[model samples]
Target: MKRVLVGIKRVVDYNVRVRVKPDGSGIALDGVKMSINPFDEIALEEALRIKERGAADEVVVASVGNADCQQQLRTALAMGADRALLVDTASAGGAPGGDLGLEPLTLARVLLALVQREQPFMVILGKQAIDDDNSQTGPMLAALWDRPQATFASKIELAGEKAIVTREVDQGLETLEVGLPAVFTTDLRLNEPRYVKLPDIMKAKRKPLDTLSLSSLGVSSRARVKAVRFEPPPQRQKGIRVKDAAELAAALKQKGLV
Candidate 1:
């Protein structure tokens, strides 16, 4: 394979507590924590491993977010992406996100144009983001591109312009034969990702990263779902205390016909 595209994201750090407002419009994150999305990291790791295995020529990591995403994008570079793309969308005046976060479909639109232009041999995505838990973008992009896709992939093989993917299914394991120019969403079991060495980290600073805008790709940033209000949830009621196992059984019996 010649070129591989890896979709990266920036999200709240994994340690932060996330709560949604009553209106379902926004999250109550304090902005005190942030990091690269985990799924994307798995994708990057698989792509780099493919390169290490002499399967692919280059790996590129891309992210759609505001200015702060650059630092996170650089992490992918440090992890071994040959280049990067940072997409900006807030300028179009659309509400960037609510409690649910940015729409994955919109980001897919931007990548559609990119795929057409780059014509990469394959595209890789994380199965889901930790916060939103919406695993739609990868499959959505595959559908948009009309290419076969494999998810939860633990092993991948590229040979003679065809990709043989091994993924985990409910029963044992399932394998698929897909041509080049396919999409893959990776799980944690794919492989262990490597940390960047000092030399590669320094070289990453010189790597080229081009900025792309929604307008340039002829895609709009408007979100279909509107979030109008936000509020906190009612405090959960405490559980009642029972004296012992016999008392708990007695309470249950008293509350019911038993």
Candidate 2:
């Protein structure tokens, strides 16, 4: 039985209230809620489906976040992961400076230890994280592991120690065949994610989630970049309503955005 691993992250859920600031960092207003990122959920779904199809034996979900993230991991387990692992970023007094703010390369470095230990047949993840919107981690991990990787995968197939991955190219869908021990970063069209039933949620409580520290992984990085100011975007102007078709056409023509 081969082992499949998927990367998951707890982030400000996409549907939550999002206030994009002048510099683009979203502001969390009072009582704003956070949840597992949507893209990651899509990846998790694909992994679960692959498992259900018996393409692989077990689905192991792992994440790097604060303690609150464990709930999200449990949610992953509920969704059908055989087990979970949380690389604790807060227990050891947080990421030295704050937020770990680690670049994709830095994260790949940190995760390599876990990856080496797990030695999964395949690694799956979302094309990009909703919060950071950086699509670099999965590819970075593949490079670190010296394995083949396909990104933005919309469709995927596995057989005879190989994977046929389909992704949306600039013009249309493009397919590529890669050998096993490959990596995939899935897009939204890959598969539909499942919701946790009460029984599954309860069952998740019994699934094991191993925890580890960054120091244990021996990860070090220079704070190459840091966000300084947070400012909200300018409020939008009130809409200018048009009554007639001609009026609408004329308005569109005036804006030259038709």
Candidate 3:
């Protein structure tokens, strides 16, 4: 169907001030506001645009998490994804002892399974998730699928079976052309996601949202990395006021900075 598979990740809303749990187990997500990862939203926006331009036939959004993740998936559908898929990890034993958090490698494996099943021409994902900020999934998926990948793509254009991607780099923007059946990770410069209108939200409810289990995908949810603990950044030291540059220089000298 010349489909474009887009990955969505559920993360604490960027607006929320995250708190470390009392026990340092993890960030307190119990009552935190959750939403689709902003980068992933950008990725979906690009995919939707591609479809709107008639370059792709279908846009399927997918996510890996508990049932709560469906909320974000439905939100993607509302954002214009034609269909949504949720890899339900709630029932499939997660981590070493059932921790719901999945590592980047595990996520790559899950996506690879989906890639094999769907055989989509292209896969799109956020360059990184806000919560973890480990920008590893896209590359890992490409390696596992043995497909070309263009990461941190600020712009993309399709021509027949090839894609020209403009990547954001420290050295400046770099461009590359890759054939179809590749992977792309979106950067912030990508198009902003469209707002989900009320009518679309209602229509999304009726869109196909299929649920799959880890077993069905032949991918294990067990995490490869164990999170020892979460620790908050140390509080910044109080700033001292100096009356003059000389005083500031003195202070700097006292601190061995000069």
Candidate 4:
């Protein structure tokens, strides 16, 4: 059976206001709202659409994080993923011990291990996660797997073992064809995800959700990059209303912006 693998991430919801820790350690997460990365949700929606069209037989969603991430996985199942895998790094000593809170490279390694095990025909992910916004995982996973990649994909069409992808580039759309077993990162223009009904939510609770230890995969979760600190962007200076064009010009001149 042809299988499609979709990578999901749990992140602070887009609506939530993120606050950097006072100690500059990281963002505060206590009792904050969390949701599946919006882009990943779009990727999963695309994967499910491909399956529905009979181009794929199964859609598997995978996430790497602590047990708290399973809630997002269940939500993916409710949305139509056939199965879920949670690569738990917390059991191996947590983030401080280099086993959790994975950086992009380590996360790519974990996804690589899953790819080898599942042997899916294709892998799909969001262009970037809202939390970190690194936008690096898809290309890194493609490099690790030695497969072609299409990033910022707005449209995907399967033709036999090949995929025709249209990507959103700064200069407009660029189309390309890649053989199966490739990686794709979705953009916002992709199809809208279906709302999970209450019945599906209940059914998802019974769907298979397998948990695996990062150690068991034999992949190193050691972070190659460390966050020294996180600081919010500087606030914009207040703007003043000008009485007329002359006043605006005078203000601009005073600020040396003209």
Candidate 5:
């Protein structure tokens, strides 16, 4: 049976206004709302579509984080993943990092272990996380696994053992064909994710969810990069309404913008 792996991440909801913590630590999350990263959601949706169409036999969803991430995994199950796996990095003893979050490189290492065990035909993940927007995990995972990858995938069609992926590039859309055992990072233009029905939510509660400690993977969680601090972007200056084109030209000349 062909299997596909989907990576899900819990992140601050895109609609929330993020703020840096006062202590120069990280972003504040005391009472902020959290959800599955939108891009990841799209990736999962594509995987489910493939399975439904009989192009794939099974879809597995995985996440790396503390126990709190189980909520997001359960959501993936509700959306139609056959099972879920959670790699608990928070409980690793003598881990190299102080933060609860795993860096992209560390995350790719964890995913590599999962890929070895599951032997999925393909792996799918969001192009970037809403919180960090690093957009590095997919490519890093592909490089680590020594497999082909297609990023920013706006469309995907699976053939016998190859995938035709349409990507959204800066200039325009570009399409490429990649063999099986590859990685794909989903973009915003992908299909919209389906909502979880109440019945499926109840069924998901009974689905298999396996949790493994990061130590078992034999991969170091030591972070290669560290976040020094979080800072919000500078606020934009207020705009003024000019009387007419002449006034606008005059103001532009005064500000040397012309």
Candidate 6:
């Protein structure tokens, strides 16, 4: 069967205001609303569109995190994925999962395992997860899996055993054609994800959601890079108004800007 695997991430909802804990340990998540990463949502939407267009037969959404991430996976199912897979990291060395310690390389390895198991025609993921914004997983996974990758894809079209992708670059949009069984990382301009209907939400609860452990996937959840600390940006100083060029010059001189 032709399948498309789309990866989703549980992150603080884009609308929520993120806050750091008092101890500089990490972002405070007490009661904060969590949702699927926006870019990944777009990726899922693209996969669904492909299925709708008859280019793909199924869309499978996957995530790597704690059990709480099941909530986000269900949301993906509601968004029209045929099934959901959760790589349960909660049991990894007894450390808490989904608490910002997992690195991108580990994530790539996990995805690589899923790709081998599922044998999907394509794998889709967001260009970056909002929490860490590392933007490294997709490329790393492609390298590890020895597959062609198209990153920052603004548009995609499937033609037989190849996919034509339009990606945004510093200069402008560049188009590339990659053979089947490739990786794609979505960009903002990719279609807007559809809102889940109440009926779809009800049906999603009945859809299959399978959970696998990192050990089961043969990928360790150990962190290669440790976060030393989390510090919020320093507060901005109040701006001084300059009534005239002389005042501006004086203010610039006073602040050593000149």
lDDT of the structure predicted as candidate 3:
0.91
Clashing residue pair totals per candidate (backbone < 3 A): 3, 0, 0, 0, 0, 0
In the range 1-258, model 2's lDDT, one tens digit per residue, is 678888888777777766654554535544667777787888889888888898888998888867888989999999999999988877555544343256678778766777788888888888888876878998898898888999899999997889999997788999999998988998888888988899999999999999988778887654565665556657899999999999999999999989
Candidate 5 lDDT, tens digit per residue, 64-181? 8888899999999999999999998667653344433678898999999999999999899999998778899999999999999999999998887899999999989999999988
Residue lDDT tens for model 4, 126-171: 9999877889999999999999999999999989889999999999
Against the true structure, candidate 6 reaches a TM-score of 0.92
Per-residue lDDT over 1-258 for candidate 3, one digit per residue giving the tens place of the 0 to 100 score: 889999999999999988888898877788788999999999999999999999889999999988999999999999999999999987865434322378888899999999988989999999999988889999999999999999999999998889999999999999999998999999999787899999999999999999999889998666557778788999999998999999999999999997
Tens-place lDDT digits, model 6, residues 174-221: 999999799999999989999999999999999999999999999877
Off by over 4 Å in 3: 94-100, 242-258
Note the residue pairs that clash in candidate 3.
none
Q: Each model's TM-score, in the order given?
A: 0.84, 0.90, 0.92, 0.93, 0.93, 0.92
Model 4 ranges off by over 4 Å: 96-100, 243-258
Q: Rank the candidates by lDDT, best first.
A: 6, 4, 3, 5, 1, 2
Q: Give the alpha carbon lDDT tens digit for every residue of 193-247 in model 1.
A: 7776888877888888888887888887767766677656588989899989999
Q: Which model is ahead, 4 or 6, in terms of TM-score?
A: 4
Model 1: colliding residue pairs: 22-231, 25-99, 26-99
lDDT of candidate model 1 versus the reference: 0.82
In candidate 2 the C-alpha lDDT for residue 108 amounts to 82
- In angstroms, how far off is 46's CA in candidate 2? 1.3
Local lDDT at 67 for model 1: 71
Error of 3 at 128 (Å): 0.7
lDDT of each: 0.82, 0.82, 0.91, 0.91, 0.91, 0.92
Residue 82's lDDT within candidate 3 is 96
Candidate 5 has a TM-score of 0.93
